[model samples]
Target: MVLRIHFTAEDLLGTRFADGPAPLLELELAVAMRRRRDPDPAFARRHRSLAAPAARAIAPLNELVPATGAGPFFLDPLSAGLEDGLELVRRATRTAVRGELDRICRNGLPVTPLLRGLAHEDRQAWQQLERSLRAAHTALVDPVWPQLRAGFDTDLAWRGQVQREQGLRGMLAGLYPGSRWLGSTLEIAVAKQVEVRLEGGGVLLLPSAQWTGEPLCGPLPDGSLLLLYPALTPLPHLYLAERAPAPGADPDEPVAALLGRTRSAVLRLTLREPTTGQLARELGISPASASEHARALRRAGLVTTARAGRAVRHSCTPLGHRLIAAAGTPARQA
Candidate 1:
C-alpha cells in the first residue's frame, strides 16, 4: 500500500512543450527560492542548504529573466488580454493547491469534492486561459527559449547526478510512505520529479531544483506542467496530500488500524455537531446505528449530546477537542 519514487531535474526539462518561449522556468524558480529563504534563521538555513544547488544552477536564469516587481504576470487588455488570462490561471492554481492541502491536513485523506468542483465550474474558463497564455508565451517570449532550454537541461542533469549520488529514493521512501518513484520532467526546464500510485489514487509531483538543496515534491504528472507543456506525457489525475498526521486517537496506531470502519464513520459525522438523523443520512446508516455510535462517542467522552427541542444534537466536548488537536499533530513527532 506504500509507494515511493525518485526524480531528477532533467526529467523536468524534458516535459517542456514549447520549442521557443520566454523562460517562465526562471521566474518560477526565483519565486520558489524566495519562498524557501524564510526570514527565520533556522528555517532559512534548512531551506537554503537544500536549495543551494538548484539556486546555483539557475543563476544564469536570474540574469536572463530579471525581476519585474510588477507582481504576477500581467496582460494588457488592449494588447490581447494575455495578462488577464495568466492571472486567472494563477488564481486557479492557488485555489487548487490550497484546497488539496486543506483536505490532506484535515481529513487525513484526499477530498475529491473540492478539486472535482473546480474542473466542473471552470472548464471553459480554464481552457480559454490556457490558450491565451500559450499564445502570449509563443508570440512575446519565444526569443528566450533556446537559452532557457540550455540552462534548464544543464541544471536538471546536475541535480539528477546529485540525487543519484545521495540515495534520494531511499530518503524519499523514508519520508513519504506509500510513495512510488516515477521519472522526472521539466516545467520550463526546472527539474520536476513525479511519483504516482501504482494501483490507484493520485500522483505526486515535485520540483528538484531549489536554492538551498531541499527536496521538492509535487503532484505526479502535475496538471499544470502538462497544460503548459503538452508535448510531454499525458497528464494523469494526481491527488496531492499535504504532509499531515494520520487520523485517529493514537499516533502509534497505523492509519488502517486507527481508522477502522466504525471509527471512521463516527469521526466523520462528529467532525461537526449533528443530530442522530443527520449522522444517519450522512453515513447511510440507520438511525439506530447512528444513535449507537453517538452513545459510544459519549461514553468515550468524545461527544456530548443534548436534547434540542425534540431532536438530540451531538457536539464535541473539551476532551474531544484535545483528542482532535492531538490527532492533528504530526504523527511522526507524536
Candidate 2:
C-alpha cells in the first residue's frame, strides 16, 4: 500500500524535540541514573524548583500540565494519550544547565554569571552550591546516558540529511503522517510577521500566511500545532491553525471587506482571544488596518473586545464563530 503522508511545517518542527539529537544528549545522564535506579535527593529538589516556573509559563497554553511517557514521544492534544511532558523537560533543562556550569567551573572558568553576578567570595560559595547541584544531576542521569546518546546520534544524522535536501516540506512529510500543505508555494505568503519574545527568553514567530490544503487543511477539530525547534527551549512550540472564512462573503469584496474577512479568520484561529498586534501580523495588514477590521467585526456583532492588561484582546461571539464556520471555502482573491 502506498503510504499517504500528511505533512506540515509544524510537524517537522515538533519532531525536533523527540527525534532530534540535542535532547538526547541533554537527557543522557538522567537516563543513566534511572537505569541504575539511583535516587539522588538534591537533583530531585532542584528539579521540583525548576518545574514550578516552567509549569507557570506553560499554564496559559492549556489548562492541564503536559504528560511524560516513554522515549521518542510526541504530544498530540487530540490524542489525549501522551503524559504531560513539560515536567520532564523542566528537569532535563535544569540538569543540562547545571552540568554545563560545573564543567566550566571545574576548568577554573569564570563562574560570575552562574553566581548571579556576585563578588568573588559569593562566587566561590555559589560554585560550591553548583557542584552540589551537578552531583545531583549526574546521579539522576548517569546510567542511561550511553544508550540514549547512541540512539540520538543515529536519528540526528538521518534528520540532518532530510532537512538539507528537502527543506521544510520533505522533512515534515517524513516526520508526520497527516500534515497538509496549505499554501501553493513552499514559502508561505503572509503580510507582516513578528517574532514575539516570551518571558522565558524564548521567541514566537507569528506570520500571517494564506494556507491551502485538504483533509487537514479544511476545518479541523479543536486543536492547534505545537512546533518545536531543537536549538531553543522555554518557548519551543509554535501554535498554528487555519483561519475559517467569512460567510455570505462577496466574491468581489472590497479590500476593506477583505480585511474584515481576514480579521474574522484570525479571531477564529485564535479562539477569539488574540491581541491586535497578533491579528495584524498574522493578516499581513497594518496595526491600524487590524484595529479598523476589529472594530468592524465588533460592530457586526461577530467579535467582542476586552482588556487583557493594557492591550485589547478579541474573541468571537458564538454567532460569529458559527458564521465563519459556515462561510465554507475562502475567496480565491486576496
* The candidate that achieves the highest TM-score relative to the unseen native structure: 1
lDDT of 2 at 62: 20
Residue runs of model 2 more than 4 Å from their true location after superposition = 1-121, 157-168, 172-334
lDDT of 1 at 129: 37
Q: What is the TM-score of each candidate against the true structure?
A: 0.24, 0.23
lDDT of each: 0.38, 0.36
lDDT of 1 by residue, 172-208 (tens): 3322212334443111212333333232222232321
Q: What's each prediction's clash count? A: 42, 27
Error of 2 at 174 (Å): 4.9
How do the residues 30-128 of candidate 2 rate in per-residue lDDT, one tens digit apiece?
Answer: 332222322233233334544444434322212111111111221111121112232333233334445544543554444554233222234464444
Candidate no. 1 TM-score: 0.24
User: Ten consecutive residues with minimal summed lDDT in candidate 1?
Assistant: 232-241
